[model samples]
Target: MYRSVGLMAWKAVRALAMSMTVVSGVSGCAAVQPASRTAGAALGLDAYYTQSVGWAPCEEGKTGEWFAETLAGVECGQVRAPLDYRNVQPDGSSGAQTVLLAVARRPAAEEKTGTLLAISGGPGQTGLDLIEAAYPPEVLAHFDIVAYDPRGVGRSTPLIQCAGGLDPDLDLNADDTEALEAAERTEVAACVTDTGLDVLRHTGSDEATNDVDLLRAVLGEERINLLAYSYGTQIAAMCALRFPANYRAAILDGVVDIAERPNDMRLGQERGYQATFTRVASFCVGEYRRDGAECPLGTDPAAAEEIFQQLLRDADARPVPVRGGSPVKATDVLDASYTGLLWPSAWKPYLAALQALRHGDGTAVRRLADFQDSEGTNALTAITCTDTAGPDHRSHSQTARRRS
Candidate 1:
């Protein structure tokens, strides 16, 4: 886990300590409760909850060799879930349709306390990537570290994708709201055309939490623990609220404030990114000074903001050339900077990439911008849009005014 120092960091540490205490001290495990006895019976989703999982060695072709290698002692499985929970049959039969959720688990090395369900961020990101990489050794030794690709993600059925690829070089800096809206509509239409609206409509956190409960029943666990990050915290929080009895403990890191509207969230994120950029600039100058090397952002931290702004202007005037790809525009550099701020380990390389970009080489920054899987973008957009209550019609100016 990335380290932070503040009240929020303390809260996270306290939460983790409390969860570990529960994991280490709990005993006299209760029998696995059938889904029919719980809320699933009322929703007519018993079939999904009772379905048995057939775990097998993951095929490298489907999971990729890197995944198999990273999670050496993992087994992959699938559990059937309703496409729309509202249309389920009373007699354990699929009403509208069913989708298979791809799951991977590494069993506890020693005495198993309970299952720890890890949910990855991005709404579109695969949870299989977190199995071994995210958890500590004690967690791996005490509980079955399990992860699942949320509906319409990764290897899950009815995967969200755009038949016509989204425009990667869309001018994000343009003030034309109509052009931006048109591009957004094009992307959404492409997703709906490829992945039906039925699936897209139900990709919200509510359905995702239901899937988590179904997973718990399939795993024969009375209650599971949750380890979720970033956007995943939404799902974990939903699970905690909707099916409190189904989970024993939850650790939500980088928590998302679910109450905020989409536009409000975006504005908050923009402010946060600006603050992080300033801090990164100061850190860059200090590190360079300590090492007796020239700092690209200059000696004064205040001047770093101007330097970056000028770079953006320069990029807009003449986009930086990438060797074999589309030219790196100002928006691409901005996106890449945000991506690089995600982890401390990447800061040094990000600084180096910025230095390179200042000299007309954008290959590094362009690579950073391309970190997100293009196919996953569809899911990210669809899930985010569907999860929110209503469409946001406000323009950027209106949003800023409301925020102020």
Candidate 2:
């Protein structure tokens, strides 16, 4: 989405063109088979995974409590890799950053065979956490489920820490000008020094594709079946494009059109939100009418619409008070709205909050702001900024205005 140099720009442009061609000419078609599959026994196939790390099971008469305590239900390990992969060694064990992996085995189904690899999105989100939440279950019954944290994110070694370590309560969109300025100081490159702009410059979609291939090889998978979401789609698409021979089947959701620039994507999102609001009005209009004349705002959708607009304007002018002596500013409003609007399940509560705010009550706004302010791992800032150097303050402001 953000190009670092001429070569990368050309490559991305070419990739985008190909993606468009595929989308127009062959989307939903069967996947192309890999030319070759891994030769040899799969890793951890000697027995099912049942420990944090691979170790022989204890014998009945053994007095070794160390092995007993170390053996768990599955195997987990960290693979240290170079901050820069171009100069990396396959056999080299010293890596500035470590990729964290956790694998679990389920009895293979009688008819189904092959391993399924699940990749999570956010480019910053932890796949380990998602996998722990029952991901890859369908694949697990038939194949082992292998999930790993990407470099510079999650519990991986040399983890990326944003400004003040991504403490979400830091008020990413602080009302105080000084605070906002201070927060922006935690640029992704600055925090992950070992992987500077040079490394970031090389960390494009191509590199991610290679990373998956390397992981596949390490896992001893003949053909990898990938299920990914969000930015994970970016990785999956690249894998399909670059390593077509290694893939078996794949599923992607919340796809990112890698052909689009970061700025254009933001603009596209604004259009999406506008459409969603329109649909919201259509679906909820009847509910408002059924509430009768005593309805808080009015039966007319226009009234609620006016309230929503006015509340956004008001928040821009003044911040709403919240717990911890914090305040909700315009940026907070945008953050809350963007998150809540992403899922339909949150639409109603988000609308109700808007209505309450329009009535001059800050309760709903404060509650939503509080939820939005909760701290998160620094991995998001690291991976996001590294992947697409991000917009300056002015550009960010412009994007926010466009959304409004």
Best by TM-score: 1
Stretches of model 2 off by over 4 angstroms after superposition: 1-82, 89-98, 101-112, 132-146, 165-206, 283-304, 348-381, 388-404
Tell me which residue pairs clash in candidate 1. none
Q: What is candidate 1's lDDT per residue for 1-404, written digit by digit as tens?
A: 22232244335323443354342112222232422224543457666666777887675545554253545678888788888777777776655788889898889898887788877788687776766554555666778878888899988888988877467767867899998899988988898888887777777676887888888888877677777777877777776667755776666666677677767777887887888888888888897568775666888999998988888889889999888877788898888887788766678878888888888899998998887778677778877767653535421111111111
Q: What TM-score would you give candidate 1 relative to the actual structure?
A: 0.85
TM-score of each: 0.85, 0.63
